[model samples]
Target: MKIFGLTGWSGSGKTTLAVKLLPALIGRGLRVSTIKHAHKGFDIDHPGKDSHNHRMAGATEVLVSSPKRWALMHELRDEPEPTLEELVRKLQPVDLLLIEGFKRDRHPKLEVWRPSVGKPLIAAEDPTVVAIASDGPVPDARVPVFHIDDAEAMAAFVVEFCGLRA
Candidate 1:
């Protein structure tokens, strides 16, 4: 799959941009999948659910299935966190893979920035950040800057940048 990324600091609207970009890419007839990285502990299971119970009982991997969907939850009990590429290998192929929040990964990324967040731009230090999407003008950024609300234009830029048609 073609890999691209969206990275930014906390409260910079990376998740919001990812959600907007999803439909824009899908509307263009591309099969797009996303991987969202969380910096903290997260739980997809409820305390009383069988899957949760299984996990609490020390099951390493718990797969919960129903008619509409299936989810596989793997416990990284003692293993080191997997690399982005390692995670990619586990997914089915797609036209695009939108990775959110792996700011340190070397893959090309669009830095989502909000000046109000008061964080420095990652693109300034990371050459892997190919573009910036900001809530305000970033005149000095070396890469192309897009208005955060302009998902269609950003989608076009991503499609061409990744050579999706090629």
Candidate 2:
């Protein structure tokens, strides 16, 4: 899959932009998938759920399935965290793969920036950051800048950046 990433410090609206971009790209007739990286421990399964119970009972992997969807939860137990490349290989093919977080990974990314966040721009140091989407002026930035709310323009840039047909 052609991959792109949305990255920023906390409260920079990365998730919000990702949500907006998904439908915009889909509207343009492109198949899209997303991978989100969390810094802390997180759980998609809750207590008392069958899948949760199975995982708690020492099953290395628990797969929950239904007519609409299925999810596989693999317990890392003693294994190292999977690399970005390893995780990407597990996904089915798609026209675009929008990654949220994973800022340290060496992939093309857009930095979601907000001046109100009081954080310095990441693109200044990270060569992987190809562009910036911000609410305020990024006068010092060398890369392209787009208004944070301009999903159409951002989607168009992403399509061309990934060399996607639509």
Write candidate 1's Cα lDDT for 23-116 as tens digits.
9999999999999999998999999999999999999999999999999999999899999989999999999999998888899999999999
Candidate 1 — what's its lDDT?
0.94
Model 2, range 8-81, lDDT digits (tens) per residue?
99989999999999999999999999999988889999999999999999999999999999999999998989
**Regions of model 2 farther than 4 Å from truth:** none
**How badly does each model clash, as a count of residue pairs?**
0, 0
Candidate 1 clashes between residue pairs 3 or more apart in a chain or in different chains:
none
Q: Worst 10-residue stretch by lDDT in candidate 1?
A: 135-144
Question: Which residue pairs overlap in candidate 2's backbone?
Answer: none
